[model samples]
Target: MMDDFLTVIALIISLNAVICLYRAAVGPTTQDRVLGVNIVGTKALVVVVLVTFIQTESFFLDVALVYALLLFVVTVAVSRYLEAEGWKEVA
Candidate 1:
């Protein structure tokens, strides 16, 4: 019973991730897109953890931890690039 409930919740989170992907694709500003991507990444991490529980596998948790770290790094790097004074877009 608990497993079924968790599976349902994971499905819901995956749906939200799809919505976040749309936001990332259509956001008017770089920050908005970055925020959307970050949200999607978080949702993905949640899904991974849920899978770890559902499947009784410990490896997915480790994967989730690594994914979280990568997500944080990417978000910080993008934010820094956006905030840099002299960054230029290449045509």
Candidate 2:
């Protein structure tokens, strides 16, 4: 019963993550798109962990961890570049 519940929740997360991706693709500003991507990435981590639990394979969570780390690095890099370009967070 718990397994089924987890699966259902994972599916919901997947659907929401897809919407986040669509938003990322069509967002008006780079920051808006980046926010979308960040949210999607967070959802991906949860999805991956759920999959790992469903499959009884703990190793899948390691992949999610690495993905999160990479996402952080990419976000930081983009933020630095934007800062250098004089993009202000005045909004």
Clashing pairs in 2: none
Superposed by TM-score, candidate 1 places the C-alpha of residue 19 at a distance from the truth, in angstroms, of 1.0
Candidate 1 lDDT over 1-91, as tens digits, reads 9999999999999999998899899888878899999999999999999999999999999999999999999999999989999877532
Model 1 ranges off by over 4 Å: 88-91
lDDT of 2 by residue, 2-91 (tens): 889999999999999998898789887778878888899999989999999888898998999998899899888886787676566543
Span of 10 residues, lowest total lDDT, candidate 2: 82-91
TM-score: model 1 vs. ground truth: 0.91
Taking all chains together, each candidate's TM-score versus the true structure is: 0.91, 0.85
**Against the unseen true structure, what C-alpha lDDT does each candidate score?**
0.94, 0.88
RMSD of each: 1.8, 3.5
Per-candidate count of clashing residue pairs (backbone under 3 Å): 0, 0
What CA RMSD would candidate 1 show? 1.8
How many Å off is the CA of 4 in candidate 2? 1.4
Q: Which candidate is the best by lDDT?
A: 1
